[model samples]
Target: MKNYTTPILILFLFLVIAIIGNITISAIGLFFNHDVFNTGVYANGYEASLNIKLIFMAKAFALLMFIYSVYILIRNLKFLVRRDFFNNKLVQCFSKSGKLFFFSGIVGFLASICGILNIAIIKDFGSQAYLNIDSKSLYIMLMILGFFLLLFSKVLDKGNEIQQENDLTI
Candidate 1:
């Protein structure tokens, strides 16, 4: 089973790279081709100079964090293939991956908030800014998944101790 782990890890790494590439390309296209700057008006019914660049920067930062988390996960998977599942290094890798996942979720949530606030601040005082909760759910899911991963690392640590004891008895 361990012999197959390497190939699977490689496949997943390639998949993550592909996904990142696609997202980068699409983001570049959207940022350059769309007229996002002139789309919104100020609270006083005047054309406001909305800093569209900040929106792009926030999105890019979130995407980079997500990519970084995926990279950490892939690195951990590679370590799992090369070392014992119960090894200290493997535990560290798992812990790091979990933290990265949680961090990515926070960064994504903040990005959404920044984007929404940017629009709201410039919009008419009485008019409501569109609040989309779709990304919020995804962010929450990421946080939960990260928590589970941390819990799993604890379980693996216990398993490692049991395996060590069994080895000594054998």
Candidate 2:
């Protein structure tokens, strides 16, 4: 229990801001990039009209949810300092965080899969200015970590019950 609230809070906020920025840019590019779409990125007559904006937005959405789960997991750490180890809120946080992380990871990975299935011309891979990077490996890690956290939460709940019963006996 290193009291990781502050750092995690900062990370959550940063991820939120990044998601907002991504959505904003994606929406702007979708709604208004007509001026540049035909001339700039579509240089080779690759007529993939179905842009991958939705996939990009989907990844952003997943990242937002993933960080939000982490935010919830760390939000109630005050109970840990108070030596209240058996609080239901702590268990609930872990449970909810695990579920959300799993869901987010699945969504992100599926989005990537869909993106890959699309015609490559639907999105410009080389013309991006470096900020449009998305990582499949990251999503895979999220899925694995989420599953472990879920199992850990169950173990923690059982331990909490045992500790409470011992306390009552004394």
Candidate 3:
């Protein structure tokens, strides 16, 4: 135990600040019809429409979920130093975070799909000011990471069972 409390707290605070900033930007972009945070301006030179709003809202929801998952994961890291690597609390933390992230990834994936389709439809008529920079790969990567976390949780759960059994026998 080399005392990771300080470093972890620092990293957590930094992440919280970044998440807050991102959420604020998303909110501003949503209310002001701005093209910030990958809202993606359309052929009309702005994101001032119902479809754009819906897509932006979906992305915002996903962003919140993703941030929350990370927060939970980081907040429950005390088990690392406590030598309680196979605890229920840690497993639940990972499991819940993994599920939330996976759901968020799905939502983001759908939003990206809708955005691409919208772009395709608009571009069919003409390609005059359409600028879409939304990365579909990002959502896919999130999904993968969430799945890994879920598997990690399962492994930890099994380890917990083994540790409990060993303790009982001793």
Pick the TM-score winner. 3
TM-score of 3: 0.77
Q: Write the per-residue lDDT of candidate 3 for residues 32-78, one digit (tens) a residue.
A: 65555442453266545567667767876787788789889877877
Clashes of each: 0, 0, 0
| Alpha-carbon lDDT of model 2 | 0.70
lDDT by residue for model 2 over 86-167, one digit each (tens)?
A: 6878778778888888888899898878777654644555323222445788788888888887887788799999998998
Candidate 3 colliding pairs: none
Q: Which residue pairs in model 2 clash with each other?
A: none
Give stretches of model 2 more than 4 Å off. Answer: 1-4, 34-39, 42-51, 120-133
lDDT value, candidate 3, whole model: 0.72
Residues 1-170, model 1: lDDT tens digits: 57776776787678667656655554443444432333343323542133444444555565566667666666666566666688776776677777767776777677677666766786432211222212766767777777877888888889889999999999
Candidate 1 lDDT score at position 146? 74
- lDDT assessment of candidate 1: 0.60
Residue 12, candidate 3: Cα error in Å is 3.9
Judge candidate 3 at residue 14 and give its lDDT.
85
